[model samples]
Target: MEKLQLQLFLNIIGIGSASGLLFKENSLFLISDNSTYLYEYQIEKASLEKHALVENPAENILKKDKLDFESIALKGNNVIILGSGSTKKRNQRISYDLKTKKIENKDFSVVYERFKKEASLSDDELNIEGLIITADKSYFFQRGNAGNSANGIFILNADDSLVFKKIILPKINDVEATFTDAILVDTTIYFLAAVENTASTYLDGEILGSFLGRIKVENFELENTILISKINKFEGITLFKESDKEIEFLLCEDNDTEELKSEIYKLTINQ
Candidate 1:
C-alpha cells in the first residue's frame, strides 16, 4: 500500500506531551502528560483554533502524578479521562462534566480503584494508554513493556462495572508489537501498535515502526494488520469521522522537545 501524507495541525508549544484526541461536536479535545488542563480545539475557516476547557488544580489532585492522560471518551455529557502513574500508583478513569465542569470524584474513584486492584497491576506495569466507550461497554487497553507480561485489553459494563472478557492476542513476529491506542468504528476496532527493534542492546535503538490493525466486532477476532507508517515514536491514534465516505485518523508522538509536534492524517477507508 502507498503511504498517505499527513497534514500539520496546531503545534501548541509547552503543552507537555499529548497522548490522545477526541472529536465531539466539530471540536477536538486533547489530553496530555502532567497537565492539569484539558484542551479543546475547533476548526474555523479551515484552521484549528484552541481553547482551554478545564484547568485542574494540583492541590485537589494527587502528587507525584504522572497523568499519562492517554485517551478521552464521552458518555452523555461526561468526559472520561483515563491515565496511570508510576510511584504512589494510581490508574484513574476520571469523569468530568462537560457543561458544568464539575469533577465527579466518588463513583469514578471507586471504579478506578476496582480496576487497578482487579488487574493486579504494579506501578511499572500499569501503563494505561487507550480507552473506547460504546453504548453499553467501556474498553481500556494497557501497554505492558516494563516486564514479561503481555498487553491487556479490558471491558466494563454500562454501569461502570468490570466485566471479564478476554481479547485474543496478536501473533505478530515481534513480541513488542503490543496494543497502544484504539478506536471503535461501527462494529470494527482499530488499534495502533508501536514495535521497537530490540536486536541491538547497546546504543539507543531506532523506533522500528508503527502499525494499524482492525478486528471485527461481531467476532472480536484479530484480522489483518497493516503497516501504517515507519515514523519515529508514534504514541497516540484517534479516528475522526468527516462523513459517510471520508474518515481522518490523527497520530501523535510523545516527544519532549521545545515544540510539541504532531501530525493529522486524513484517509478514506474502503468500506
Candidate 2:
C-alpha cells in the first residue's frame, strides 16, 4: 500500500474535541466535548468556513449538573448527542431539533434499554462513541474505549428497535485497536482506529497512536488499515471527495498545547 500525505486545513484552540462530523444540504456540522454546541461550516469554492454555532437544546433539559458530549448524529433537523460519566453508569442520549430548537430526552432510550437487557450487560459496558444514521433512518453506533473487546458496533432500526450487534475485531498486530470515528460514502465505509500499547504503565494503558482504515460496505470487511500520521492525540475523522478518481481524508488531532488548537490533514488513497 502507498502512504498518502495529510494536508492541514484549520487549527482552532480550546474549541473542544471533535467527536463527530456530518455534511448535509451543503452544510457541515461538527460536534465537540465542552458544550453541546454544533459548529456549522459552509462548503464554498471547494473549501470550508465557519457558518454558525447552534447550542444543543436538549442540554437544557438535563437535570444532571455535568455532562460530557461524546457523539452526535443528524436526522432531518434533529440531532442526537450521547454521553457517559465518570460513574460508569448507563450513558445518556439526548435529541435536539434544529428547526424548533427543542430538546427531547430519552428519544430512543427504550431501544437501548431493550438491547441492554437482551445482552445482559450494564450501561457502562456499552461505551457508545460513534453514531451514524442510514438512508432508511436506521441508527448505527460504535463502541468507545473501556470495553471488554476491541470491536463494538450496533444497529437501531427505523422504528427505534435494536436489530443487530457485531464486534469489529481489528487486524492482528502488536498494538491495541480502538475505533474513533467513521463515515459512509456511497457503498464504502471509512473509519479511523488508534493503535497503541495495551500495557502502558505510565498512562494506564491508554491509546497513544492512531491509523485510518477503509472497507467496502458489501461484506463489511477491512480492506486496508494504514498508519496515516504520527499524531499527538487523534479524535475525529472526516472524508472529502475531490473527484471520481481522487479522494481525501480530514483527521482531527487534540493536542493540549492548544485547547482546540487541533490539526486537520488531507490524505489520499492508493488505488
Candidate 3:
C-alpha cells in the first residue's frame, strides 16, 4: 500500500469541529458537531454559505447542550443529518428539504437502544458516526464501532426497523481498530476506521492512524485494506471518482486544543 498525502484545501472558521460531509448536485455540505447549521461550500465562488439546521432549530432539532451531527446523506432534495450515538442524542436525526429549506423531525431514539443491543453494544459503545443510503434505496447503512468484532454496520430499513451486520477487522499492531465513516460506490462499501492510542468512548478518540477498507455488498466481507494517512483525528470522508482506479477524498479533522482551528484535506486513494 502506498502512503497518501492530504492537500490543505482551506481553513474554515466557526465550524468548531466538522463531523460529516456530503456532495449533492452542485453544492457540498459540511456538518458541525457544535451547532445546528451546516456549512454549504460553494465550489464556483470558493466560499461558504451557512444554512440553519431546521426551521426554529433552536427549539426543535438540536439539543440545548451540544449538537453532535456526525453524518450526512442525500436523496433527491432531502438532506439527512445524523447525530453521533455517544449519548441519548444518537436518535436525533433530520430530513431537511433543500427546496423548502425546512427540517422534517424524525425520531430514532426508540430504535437506538434496540439497535445498540443488536450490535451487542451498550449506550457508551454504540459509536454510530457514519451513515450511507443503500444502492436500492431500501435501507441506510449506519456505521458503528468499539473493537474486535463489535464494530460493524447497521441496516435502517425503510420501515424504520434495524439490522446489525458484523464486521471483523484484523488488529493493527495488536491494537483494535474501530469504524468511523462510510461511503458506497456501486455495490462496494468503503468504510474508514481508526486505531486510537487509548480506548476512548464513542465521543472522539485520539487517532494514531486510519485505514480504508472495501467490503462487497453481496457477501459483506472485508476483502481489502489500505493505509491512507496518519492524521491525528479523522472524522468524516467523502469521495469523487477521478480515473478508472483512483478516487479523490475530502477528509475532515478536529484538533480542539490547537488554536481552536480545524481543517478539511483533499487526497486521492488509488485502488
Candidate 4:
C-alpha cells in the first residue's frame, strides 16, 4: 500500500483521552483510558452524548485508580471495552448492551494473568492496547512500548485458554513502533501503531510518529504499512466507510493529558 491520504475529520474538544473507537449504525462509540464514561457521537446531528459506565460518573479518574480502558470491539449487540492491564487497577473489562443500554463489568485479572504467564511478561511490561473478537475467538494485542518487551497477540480460545504469539513490528523513523489498536476486516487485520520514546508504560514520551498496518489473520504475517501522521499519537481506529475502491478509517488521537481536548482523523486508502 502507498501513503494514506489523511484529513482532519473531527476536532473533538472537552473529552478525555480517546483510546478506543467503534462505529455501528449511525453512532460512533468511543472510550477514554482514564474516564468511567462511554462517549456516543451521532454522525448525522454531530452531537455527543456521555453514558456513565459506573453508577457515579466523574470527569476524570486519577491515573493510579483509573481502569485504563484501551480497546473497544463489537460483539453482536454488545460493545466491549478492555483495559490495558499494565497494572492491577486496569484489569476490568466492560460490556455495554446496545439493545438494552445496560452495563456489565467483569474482572479480567485471571485472563491477564494468563497472558503474562504465556508471554513471559512482567507486571510492568504487559500493556494490552487492542482487542478483536470473532465468533469463537478474541485477540488481545500487547503493546511493546515498555522495557525490553516484545509486542504480542494473545488469542483466547473458547475453552478459556490462551495462545500467545510474539509479533515483530517495523520501526518508524528509526523509532520502535508498538501496537495501539486494531480492527478485523474480513480476513485482514488493520491496525494502528505508534512510536514513543519512553521505556515505561506509566510514563509519557515524545510521539515520533504513527502508522496504519495490515496483517493476515490466518498466518499473522504483516502485509503492508502506511504512514498516517508524524505528530499525532493515534490510539484507536475503526472503519468509517468502505467501497470497492477506497476504505475510510476513523482514528482517535491520544496526547496523554487531562486537558479535555482530543482529535480524530479520517484516513483514506485506495485499493
Best by TM-score: 4
- Give the alpha carbon lDDT tens digit for every residue of 1-271 in model 3: 2555567866766565677787765566888676677778766676777777655543112333564687887776788887766677556788888888887767777666777677677666666677777534333344434442267777767666667787876566666666767777767887777777555454444566777778887778888877666664666788744577677777777553323245877877665
Q: In candidate 4, how many Å is residue 19 off? A: 0.6
| Clash count in backbone of candidate 2 | 7
Tens digits of per-residue lDDT, candidate 4, 1-271, equal 6846888888776687899889888788999988988999887888898889887877668888888899999998999999899999899899999989999999999988888889888998999999999998999999998877888799998888789888788786667889999999889999999988788888788998998999999999989887777888999999989999989999998878887876778899986
Best by lDDT: 4
Error of 4 at 9 (Å): 0.8
Tens digit per residue, CA lDDT, model 2, 142-258: 443454433455665566556544545353355556666676767776777765554321122434566777767666667777776554345566666656666776666544221
- Which parts of model 3 are misplaced by more than 4 Å? 1-5, 54-64, 135-149, 159-161, 202-205, 257-260
lDDT of 1 at 71: 68
| TM-score of each prediction | 0.76, 0.73, 0.84, 0.97
Q: What residue runs in model 2 are displaced by over 4 Å at the alpha carbon?
A: 1-3, 24-28, 41-66, 84-90, 95-109, 118-120, 137-139, 159-161, 171-173, 196-206, 256-258
Candidate order (TM-score): 4, 3, 1, 2
Superposed by TM-score, candidate 4 places the C-alpha of residue 179 at a distance from the truth, in angstroms, of 0.3
Which pairs in model 3 have colliding backbones? none
Candidate 4 collision pairs: none
lDDT of prediction 2: 0.55
Error of 4 at 208 (Å): 0.5
Candidate models: Cα lDDT each: 0.60, 0.55, 0.67, 0.88
